[model samples]
Target: MKKLNFTSITKYTILFLIALLLTVTAIVFLEGRKSKNISLWITPASYFNEGWYYFDSDSRRQEIDSLPVRIPADKFGTARIYHKMVRSSHYCMYIDYYAHHQAVKAFFNDELIFEYAPPSNPGWLKSYRSFHNLIAIPLNRDGILCIETKASISSTAGEFGQIRIGSRDELLNRIVSERLPQFLLGAVLIVLGFILFIITAFYLRVAFDRTILYFTLLLIFLGVWQTEESRLLQFFIGFQALHWFFEYMMQPFILILSFLFIKELFINKKHPALIILFACITLSIFTQLILQITGIAQMTSTLFMINSMFIVVFAYILVLINLNFEFARKSVKVIFSISIALCIVSFIISSAVKHHKNFTDPILYLGIVFLFISISIFVIQKTQKQFNAVRSAEIYKKLAFLDISTGVSNQTAWYTLIENFSADGIKLDKYCMFMFDMNNLKTINDQYGHLEGDKAIRSFCECLKRAVGKSGDIYRIGGDEFICLCKNIDYTRATQIENMFDYYVKNQTESKVQFTAAHGYAFFSPSSKADFIQAQSMADKAMYENKILSKKGRS
Candidate 1:
């Protein structure tokens, strides 16, 4: 048997464990804080989940052990749920429940109290389909509470949610408070998405990848969907139609954005399966919209079809992951795979347990949060890697043209500038070139050491740079030899610069060794029509003459 190596696997396992621990810690901390806040002000409401009986339109009654019991898919007609309410001393008692795509009528002691039957139009029916119902119940009167629900479409049939009884204020508070964490989470995602959008637009545009843009969009849509699903917005907006429209419309977009994000994450490879998936989803969304507009079918009725499409999407993602397993980064592969698995499991569970519809699915929320976190990590890592690459390239380019020893443009940069000037057909008369050779550098090196020689050379270069400032460019072409190219300078300005350079060299006191340089400048005459090489020769010749004169004066 051959021995197997698990070194890479072990390393990634450790990383995944650490990441998981941190994520769990953060969730626990947030939940703990929420729990503490809830305890402070929220009063728990009594849920009437059991001891109920349901009757169909045919007058056939069936025993319901719990409040939330799914009616048969085939059953579509008027239905009634009867539960005896306990007499309460509270002056204002209220019963709250959620009705999905069903017209509701509430009665107490065979007397009608509340009705929510909307117009028969499909559009009107869709707008009123799903909502939180809060009915004021009479207090100090013992009577049977009858909730009559009617569902015309079979898809919307049999879905009932938990009923709660409490004071009106208490029940309202409970409803909002229960979904507050989810609402806030969604709001945070939306805010974060917009912030990322602004940053990418203004600051990171050059270095940003489309992957991050897609991720930002995913966050925004996901937040919108989550917030809408929480149904807390209905309380404030007071427009069930608008909320319902957004609730259904945002789903396909969220799915599309997710796919786009994943596609970009895989280096934008256009897989055939992915293309087909995109086309299919797009077609389905448009078809659903058309059906909704024509009143032929409602978006809610086609949810199973959408759910099936997503199942295909998740399956395709798994297949794609497997195909790219060897090439994907360890962190990305592990984190993304785990998150997708969690999301798929949660989605399946949420779909399977349809009867329990009191609050937004927390497990699905966790999976989504985890997936977003994983995407954030991947995108940030990729952006950081690209940033490092760009920074390194810039540093390399700068170092290529810089003289590390003298803090000046090096010989390579001088040649490059000359090439550029020649390529652009620059006239020699537009610029003046100066040649400089440091005096007594050999003697300084022989007497004081090479370090002293280097100091002298640097001192001379600094004097030249300060005198020239922004008006000219300086290059250290060789040891103790420098060149200055000044463009668009007149004779008077050139003289002033030369005088300044001499003054700076004379007054220099930073080094123990005296720093002096012999420099010669030549203005290119238009009459001579000289090339740069000839002009450089003229400057070099003048520099030698200046050196000889300086030596004679010293003697």
Candidate 2:
């Protein structure tokens, strides 16, 4: 029942600031000790069978030597060595220096099955230094194979920091020191999301209407997806399979959150655009599921493109909704812009990694972090606004029902009251009705002013409202006339209400303009009573008689 203490932005900013501080402090203090850059000494044959591999990182020399292992020639159609190398330990700085960018050419009796970096022109790393490639090896009729790496680079050695390999035994050490920081940060973010979900669930009874349940579920899903352990599912099922599943699942959830978040933000739910967006998302999800089950990976690119388009469109709608509100508009713009930027970055990273097996760098995950943070903030801001709007609406509804001048039920609300108390019978239970008129109201308006007459009415209604208390209804149906109706009346309670009105008048003033109210009542058994109409007519006449008696006494 208290007013909102701060603006929407102030409240939401505090929330995100606290979360950010905790995350940053924990990461810096707990895991800040620097980790050595690990050399990835893995090879394709490493997965085929188990073997030992040597990883060497000298001043400018990066080498990976895997012991002899059986190459699977029956499957994968012409097996080859894929060279994927990335500099580790340095974040926020582009280190794309390839000291020696050549693959160790594999051969079967000198018959070349494939070549790794097909003879590039000089100065390829004029901008940066990194190398990733796949070198092929031929097989004899006896399933025998030979594999080796050949390297040629400038004599000028470059200062390099770290190296990682994906050969035989090193396969278990999938994530290295540099990668752990990012994965850990992701874990923290996911945990924060879960905490938020728990907080929301606590107030679930108050806030969980039909609409909010959808968003609550979404937050839970997001929390689970961003966890470090969730990513470990990749080890059980291959990375490619996990990648495909995630890409397909993200579209539908994004659409649901978009609609729910926007509705909460603006506090308006009548937008027609939401239906169309949902239809598109549902269709896309269904289409993607079918394509995935059909064992077709080539169509994934096209599916991704279409899905990305829908996401962009959904974010654009959010931008439009946010533009109307001054405080939220800027935040919305920031969120949408970041989303688009992240989508583009991820697309580029994925394509680069696909064409050249450079999966070591952390571009996609970085974008994901930014995207989650921005969207989470936006969702929280929206929820707060929705809460305030609903609260204000209830206040306004109560205000509308009562007469501000009389502090009693207005004529507009009296019928609704009758419907609530009415019984199912030809005639309702015994009741008493009191009608009141201020004596010489026209004279008072002529002598003093309408304002003075208005004060008398307000004062009388206050007395009436207080006296009615828990057992009766009072109405300001006319300018100077009022009605009090009591159901199943005991005259003792009735006399108290009437006496309280008289006491209020007697204590106020003894002037000529002293106001008094005429009272009347009618009681009957349901079988004998005619109806509300006939009963009210008798009460009206009785009240008139009392008014005449009061006038005579005053004279």
Model 2 gets an lDDT of 0.52
Error of 2 at 96 (Å): 32
When summed lDDT is taken over every stretch of 10 residues in candidate 1, the lowest stretch is 420-429
| 283-304: candidate 1 lDDT, tens digit per residue | 8888887877776787777665
TM-score of candidate 2 to 2 decimals: 0.50
> After TM-score superposition, what is the CA distance of residue 528 in candidate 1 from its true location, in Å?
24
Stretches > 4 Å off in candidate 2? 1-218, 228-284, 295-369, 372-402, 415-434, 485-491, 509-513, 521-542, 548-555
Query: In each prediction, how many residue pairs overlap at the backbone (N, C-alpha, C within less than 3 A)?
Result: 1, 25
TM-score of each: 0.67, 0.50
Task: Give the alpha carbon lDDT tens digit for every residue of 1-555 in model 2.
Answer: 656656976998999999999999999876756766454544322232222222233223223344222222212123233233233342211111122323334444546554444243222321111232233222213322334433333221222212233432343343333245555655666566566666655753236443345455554554444432234434444443344335345545655565565555444456666556556666766665555445342233334545464445546544654565444656566765567567556645654464332362355555556556555555566567766776788779778778887778777676555445445578557777776666677877888798888787777676666777767777776787777777787878777777777777666652336777776656544433245546567767877898888879989
